[model samples]
Target: MPQNKKFGTFAGVFTPSVLTILGVIMYMRLGWVVGNAGLIGAIVIIIIAHVIAVTTGLSVSSVATDKKIGAGGIYYVLSRSMGIPIGGSIGIALFVGTAFSIALYLIGFAESFNAYLGFGTTISDLRLTGTIALSALTILALISTSVALKTQFIILAAIGISLISICFGSTEFVPTTVHFFSTENAVPLEVVFAVFFPAVTGFTAGIAMSGDLENPKRSIPRGTLYAIGVGLLVYLFLAVFMAYTIDAEVLKTDYNILMKIALFAPAVVAGIWGATLSSALGGILGGPRILQAMSMDKVTPTFFSKGKGQNNEPVNALFLAFVIAEVGILIGELDIIARVVSMFYLTAYGFINISFFLESWANPDFQPKFKVKRWIGLIGFIACFTIMFKLDMIAMIAALAIISAMYFGLQRKEVKLQSNDVWKSVWENVVNKGLKRIDAQVEENSNWNPNIILFSGKSDHQKYLLELCKTVSGRTGIVTNFKLILDKENSKPPLKKIDQIVRDEQFKDLGIFARQIKVDNIYNGIKNIASTFGFSGVEPNTIMMGWPKGIENSEEYSKMTQALIHLDYNLLYLDFDRVSKFGNYSSVDFWWRETDSKNAEMMLNIARFIIASPRWNDTNIRVLFVNNNNVDVSIIETKISKLVEDLRVNVNIKIINNAVEQKTFYTIIEEESIATNLTIVGIPDFNPEKQAEFVLKTNSLFESIGSTLLVKAAQNFNELDLDLLNK
Candidate 1:
């Protein structure tokens, strides 16, 4: 579903989520609090916060680089190693937390806007502005997807303007007498720690956007750490400026801290206003992307997968986020909600770190590309939860209630899905990791590109298969699998030579992989293989055969194709007419049936594979979707539109009214069957009732073809192998 040209790595990962977190903070409020703690104490808080942020960032990074990441992102990793149910619960939690974030940000924006308008700050004023803020949030959520390209522009501009304004406005202001360290006016350490805890929480927020990162393994750590480093420096500078310029009594008062500084230099108001607005926009736009990813994976409702338009934007999810956040703003208010958000996030951090440790030690087969001494994860966990005790117990109670409701109402399904072993392990890791970083398994790497794996039987032709696997294993790391299905029904003698050769050669190759199994039939056999491996569904980007041999052109090809149509897996037929010599093809093309499982998946795979091949570098891939009278025209248009949006490959949709007149149908088919690479058509195995409809549309098209590939829904390559030979 992604475009062939790679997206910029800069804005995808860190910019959206991190900026949302950092920008949302009431900078002047923080400055005033830190100034009250005196310069030396404020620096200590900054130092501790950065250390925690860096440690957590390293933990998150290590888990991300271990393997291929999905667009479903970090949740996919957790779901894969864990189970669907635990991952689902975490997805729900993230959705709620992100929604709350949107609401809290909008509330901040409205309050800031009212204050800037010279309206006095009051609960009534905030509530009145909440109404307008909700409307704005809704509008922004809807438009966010359509104008996704402009988000980076808006965020970068806001960050630059706010930073410059803050620096210039506070430059000339200094107090008559400054205290670097003073116990006389200092707040209790417990209270100071409680208020200071939320400051560093924003730094690790970048991990939340794991779904969008172009290179999350590298970018998430860099962006998260950078945000913390910059935020700490900014916090330190503002604290010193406030302590040096503003009197102690004035700094302790309820007056807007930034506004007081604005009086000394009028420009600071613009920076405060800009920061609040950017924070809201960032949350409104960024959070929905993850929701969209989850929806596509079927963890949430299917509606999220149906985005506003192009880019698969989750319009419904965004709207829901806005509604939840607006209610939070109206009920919890800014200060209370901000603290609750911090608490919820700290809980999430703890779980994620636990997930990281489990990934390394629990699975000895999976070693991390980056890791920490076990004590670092332990201390980071402790540091996070320790601050929660200092939070307003009332807010913490409210957060716990929300979490419990989420667990019972939404996550209960997940709890049922997990094994006792999984639950016990997760809980043990969570407790051991400490309370600081909650383990929601938020580790996602968006850097790994999508790939297509071609599967074939590993037997007498193992040598040829190995060569093909090596050929496709170019720069993109195209994966090919050799699957051998032993028929238990036949109960034939096992091949000792084949087994030895498989181990010494195919498995011996640095990149080639193989699997052998005994089963009833190829179809069921490969399905078992797919299930054994960690693939959700049929793994959309897979080709189920190498070459169908010994079977003459007959009903067998059509039957195999028909069965595949039901399974919805891509069928690749090596063209005997065009590239029969093997490894010397000049071009590759694909035909499409209207009911084919999303042509984008197949087309992208074909395009990427062909582009990497020396045999077909300049090839042009083709897609032909048959539109018949029986098929709904609107559905055809929607499918065509989606294909165009998702892939750059050329596709032609043939609208056939009827084949009642065989002559006319034959003419159309002959025209389509001219000099071409390959013709792909979906075989009819699904929708038995629609068999009549499919025959009317596709039968004539199938019979009058060129080098046609009867696409069917088969299991993995293992099933396809036996299906081909038996048919």
Candidate 2:
């Protein structure tokens, strides 16, 4: 528990890692792997396994150099890089995997010990021995991590002596020829690789000690890589030695072949015992730290974050890990536990690689002192999962499904972490690059989309107007809502910030970019702002506002509308009906006129946008053309039908052939669209001198309609086409 008792590279990282790497699998399973896969095939498996391991180690190293590592080791690194949601999922999996690993190592130790008793041992006997071992190791880990790690040194010595004995030991029986490939009846190479993989996974034992290290960034990379290199050499040497020293049949049948091949048989026995116990101890020490880290991050219950004594040892978390390991021991099958543990570890390792890949690729500020090629992390990620499915597809699927469920569950919690900023930066980079590409292209009428700027006044006071603008823009276009404040006092920094926050809160879920703008005059301010509102590629091409309440500012509104038109901005004025508020959202009427074809086309586009929303998805549209000309009614109907067909919208066309003297245009609109939920009308062109008269006449035109959208096109548009609507 003492703070000054932290470990350096040798005792902290290299010792635990090498001892674990050389543990139970190397002693108990290497001969079986060599027998099933033969010398050359075994070497290939070793290389493939180490390729994944070395790359993952490199990724870990690179990330460690960039971030200051805390108690949870890989959990801390992943959560800090990828955000808490993903990090918590992998962290929980890694904790359980480490706990299961304890049971695996203990079972290995018990199997070896029971076989040494020279009795007919049953599964019950192995379980009993494992349970006892688990108890002893739990007690040792509970005392202190420093004590448990220090014990690994003695275990390391025993493994070193056993390996030396194997190299020099004499064997009476020998094969006539060395088997370079798998023997008949041998299991598949992937199956053999899965069993052998745990041998090299011990490198993380050092990484798990990140919080207890004197200097984690320096010790972790140096010690982990060194341990991997050493383990690789030892495994390769033993595979070749066993292939030449004894027959394949003997190697296949005898799990204790390492002991028999050693010059001093008892030394190999001691080594197996040391190896398994040490790896179990490593898991006992490391697993709880992961839980503790998650608890600290609020990914798990905070109670588990409580630690004991001077070093703040994760005592409560350690107990939870002990219970999980005890349950794993009750399963009482080494191979089964190994497979489950492999799946969990592979999931964690794959995400670790992904964390490094995303950090390096997305974050410009990700500068690491110990650098690795970004692709190495990517390759490692792919290889880990590939090997996982090859080992056991059902297990792989179950593991991923569990991780995914955990991720979603964590997402609902307000467990915010600074690591989530990486995604913000990623999105910014994508938007900037995309905007540059869009800027280089020429503007075309066929590519026209509504990039609207709404003079919303106050978002609370104009909720209907805000909703209409959002629905018209849909998902394909952009909507920027500006609350134009007439008072210059509101433009001060603190008040502006408060106003901005209020605007953001109001429009956060609406997907509308809301801002507050200070203006001297309402009409001039809107005219100037609408004229220069956005960037070259994604500029606001349309200006929308609610209908003026009275004729008091009719002249100012008319001048602003004229100025926006001069600046090539299409205009939309909504006259919202507070009584009906879109009246059941069932029907929409569009009044089309050939003389105002541009405004009619804009009206059609707006109607299509309205129908695209879920609230109006079932709305029926009708296009009405009052044919007062002497031209044939059938020909006008045909042209209107063709236009609707080109736009790909399902709308009924109505041709009202009546004399101009019999019914006025306003009277026809009022009678025809009275039953519809919403009506779209074209704004007539008017001179600036008669602005008040125009506003008064237009306000009286749709007095009986449920709700109306009056549209004015900036200029004549090309004929309506499929591209304009679909894009």
Candidate 3:
């Protein structure tokens, strides 16, 4: 049997969030924000900051409805969507911000308390009393969260009474001139916003109590958004009242303006302290819960995971929180803590939006009852990050560095329970974007990125052949390890083997997939998948294969090549040997055949790709031509320059003017490519009967020239108005 839930929205979320929103800042610094920013600028700052919070609230609501929202609230949602490392980092940061905020709010309570008691608002006086208040709140929070939250009900009543009295204190409508913008107080609006933004961020106070909630998924969204709405209304009323009734200079200097102008001044003073003390209590309670959640997640050390007291209270976490709060007290300034806290909170908010955005975009299972436009998350991300940079660059960088360090550290540890996240969604979208860019400009020569489909009989046996194709494909294109099983049924073909090859650790950076197809004939299976290969934005543009074993097998190879080439697939035939020879890679020998630059375009480009890889790092890419002197050297140089210059890669050009026969051609291959591991050659036009024999002899002749890749340009077929390719 389970214990019943003991709290609802009003007590659990709204009271805490509203108290914190109307905390030290509203009582002490909203006047300063208004003074520096003026009436219009103050309203602008409030709206912009709240818009980000409200948008994040909406995103939170959207994500909460999609799944069984867990104990960590914002951290849970972020982890479930974006992955643990990132969510855990932000969760810890949020905990620190919450802990530090306890000190900030206590200091506010002490300052206002000292003034009410007829003592001047001195730093030393506030620090002494603030430490005492911190001690009291830590005891109350550790007593039980329920008891602490119950006390917030009383604080809420005091704040409400104070608000009512404040309205009654000023209905004169003196109509002080409200400037659109101002720096009359010698304070920048960005600085003023940094002071005020922390107010609305307290809406997450309820979310941090997610572990203790009855129906967290339902309660969290309701509580947080309600807090934001109520806070907005109260601040709007105060802003308008202050703008119409009080003079700008007076508003600027008065830290206790609410107490000074309220109908019942003493009651307002109690309300200010009540608001401050409640916010400190809320932070004290929430901060520990966040820590406990992180510890349970195993992102932090597990020592903080224990909840020893009755009703499973976070005693150990609360002790740590108290220790941190004491350290915050040593800093002895509310405004400094306020600014730093704002940075962490804003960073958390940015990730919240990012998590939601990724959840919606990546996961098809992510169907929330409450839907928002995708742009809302995007806007929230921009707003939070923008305001953070505007407030303080150093603080923002420091916060990000801390989060990044935590993310990497957790990632390094490799937690045992791996939950699915939007990592696939992120990479899939990246691959999709590249495909879309390629698809959109199919007409342009330069826009093409290779998508090679290899007709590998048992590709895993010679994985390096596919790797060479992958390196040539370079991260931009897709590489499929295809196996043709000779049967009608499409049964499995050692899927673990296929998966191993597809996820080859060495070539993980490239786009790779695996498939095993069964057909009566190899050509039909190759043709069928190739015709329908890939999703939108990507399709097979090239076909690669190892040179067949026998002279009798040449007909099938030629047919496969022609059929795919007819589909506009650029074809390459690899005559393999070893990848490394001569003790370090040498050069790529590219046989530049036609002057149209169209025929040898892909060959030249592939040679460039080969030499660029880590395996062939600094290997020279020389453009070799069997020149009969028909094409001028200057014409060839100009064309090569135009092509290679745009590529921003290096290459060398060589002319072989010897009237080359097949005998001399094989000699030229051996001599010119002696230091090279790979030679790139274009398949010349020849009779079908004789071509196979010619290729077999050519392969044998260049066997010592290392591995040779024979190329034929399919793009030239489309350029030549070939009708078979269009089909």
Candidate 4:
């Protein structure tokens, strides 16, 4: 929130321009392609690159103006407009691409150094130069990222001075070259696009500075488009200069092609060398913010998102990016690096274009202020896809393979609960799709049912739960109600000198009754509370109750109060894990009697409810939708399809049509309990009082039998609404 925690107008424009310079410099390596294609091909490439940059920038800025953007800004747009999963994929792709670009930039750094030092005569010296540059870059990255963006002002200024020198000094070095007498081809047209595609990209790098910009919408569009146009002009000027001044044959075989031009005019070498260094450092300092955003959104681990140093920079991810780039620098395969980086950005941009169209189709309410006429969005999509196909297919496939793995891997943790109606679907997804960290504590108690106990020593505890119960029950219109027992008789120590203590211990018990009806007798009041909390105009089934923690003699009371409270109040003990640890729920095992169990659909839904809790996240889930298997395959498939389609948890289906699969299924449950950290078993038995005892025993085993839970799926689910589940 400090005002100075942002980039100035010049700095904003400078960052993306640096990235653009880094990208465009690749044409030097691909000069033969430009030389072969003649001026027309060069013109076409420049025009297409500009159009892509302008249209994409406009599309991005259009969204930026309407929303308060963050460093993780683009994903917010993608998630809100499309959905979180696809947004997550784009987040990963963008980060990986930017990180890899640092490597490509470093390779350029080493080559520039080799050319200036004239060390390419020996292979070992070339490797040493690459090593020295990469090490220096790694250290520089750590320093620049350690401070706030304000400290980078001096660095940016130096870069500007250097660029000016390169422009002015190079004019005197222009050498006359004879025109070609015959036409000849070297690299194919497809190969030229493949190599130069990454070089002409990265205008969107400015968007990562959104968190540091005063008016990102206005600034990002102007800065991004201007940087692209200016970078094109710069590239064109340098390309023309190098073409006329340097020998084409020498440039083709030379690693330090730019340095040769700088050498021809001694005054320009220092300026161009400094310009290349500034371009590398500028990218190093800015790109990791996007990675930090990606990590915060769960595309990567949480470590990258944590604030570091007094400035709260995303230091971990920044350093990680540099380290990855260094490894890439050591390999120094320009073709492989270029191909990978292109595939990364193109894949992400392709989605950006699709989300534009999907937003119009699925969410008509999202209207961009600066619309890229629908056809332009379509054109952008085609251009991105076409470029993607022409790039290295092997690289594209490899990038996608990694992305898809992370996509589903991360999706398991992002599931949220809806209404009680979806509880079964939720449960199924968690068991089937969630991430499971191996923990002995949870594994031991996997079969044990932890009671769903709500607490109310403080008035807020009961109030929040009561409101939630009403919300859940109202939506499902099912009989999901809870019991309230106020312990007014609990001893309160006498205060000294007749001092009064302000507290509301008894208010907890009487709070539910205060809503509409008052019960004079606490015993009969339990039933009345149940009816009131239960779905109105519907038969009562489940009553939710809060467990008192941090109070003495509460455990005994928790056990004794269940029978009096209502055999229906299934006690659920909530686990509130840290936000960083939040993820998928592991193991949703349903107990089904042949007649009543087909509601395995309902049971899968219950697991999703468990996942919404912070405690169960980042845990793997096992879904048991049991069928006695006497039912037809078509019916089972219908139920299974619905469960998979609707629920978002990791699921495994078990069909116990006979005693054989049933025995195997039960054994599987034991094995699952040992393997996973948590287990959920639906209350298959029907005796309310006996079920209450089962719930109590299950809660007692929280420490010994494995971290297990028992939910009366049928009892409480009837009252939950479908819409208010996540809230």
Estimated TM-score for each candidate: 0.52, 0.91, 0.88, 0.53
Candidate 4: where is the Cα deviation over 4 Å?
1-4, 22-32, 120-127, 144-185, 237-251, 255-267, 360-362, 415-727
Question: By summed lDDT, which 10 consecutive residues of candidate 1 come out lowest?
Answer: 718-727
Top-scoring candidate (TM-score): 2
1-727, model 2: which lDDT tens digit per residue?
3345789999988888888888888888888898999999999999988988898899999999898899899988888888888889999999998998898899889888999878445778888899999999888887877788878888888888888887788777578888999978998887788778878888888888888899999999999999999999988888888899988888888888777778998988989999999999988888888899899989999999999877788989999988998888888877778777878888998988988887888888899889899999999999999998888898789888999999999999869886554566677778888899989987667635889998776534477788778899977899888777786555544345656634456587778888776777788879877767799779888888887768635667667777788898888888888787788889998887656667767776777788789888999989998866645777777777787776677888898876555577878898898888888888877778877776777788757777888888867466443221112
Give the whole-model CA lDDT for all candidates, comma-separated.
0.54, 0.83, 0.76, 0.52
Candidate 3: which pairs clash?
Answer: none
Candidate 3 local lDDT, 399-478, one digit each (tens)? 88989999999899875346678778778777777768856864654544777888776544366677777877765667
Candidate 2 minimal-lDDT segment of 10 residues: 718-727
Cα lDDT tens digits, model 1, 208-277, are 5555556666776567666666666766776776677666556655335565445333444555555655
Cα deviation in Å at residue 565, candidate 1?
Answer: 64
- Measured on C-alpha atoms, candidate 4 has an lDDT of 0.52
Worst 10 residues of 3 by lDDT: 718-727
- Best to worst by lDDT, what's the order? 2, 3, 1, 4
**Cα miss at 406, model 3 (Å)?**
2.2
Higher-TM-score candidate of 2 and 3 = 2
List model 4 lDDT by residue over 1-727, tens digit each: 5434556545665454554454425423545444543435544665665566555655666666555567765665565454556667777777767777766665655565666666572445545665676567657656655243444454445545544554454344343662232136344555655656666666665676676676676676667667776777765665565556555555445544443434234433443444445555555655677777766666667898886554456778777877776666666766567667777877777767666654543343455555555555556677777766665667667776876876676578673222121123334445433323222124331211222222223343444444433322332323222233344553543233223222234434323322222234443555444444422222244434443234323444434445533564543333221231112344334444443342444555555555554444444545444444456645664555555555565655554445345553345455545434445554445444464454444444333324343444434333222121122
Question: After aligning candidate 2 to the native by TM-score, how far in Å is the CA of 487 from where it should be?
Answer: 1.3
Scored against the true structure, residue 582 in model 2 reaches a CA lDDT of 84
Report lDDT (Cα) of residue 664, candidate 1. Answer: 45
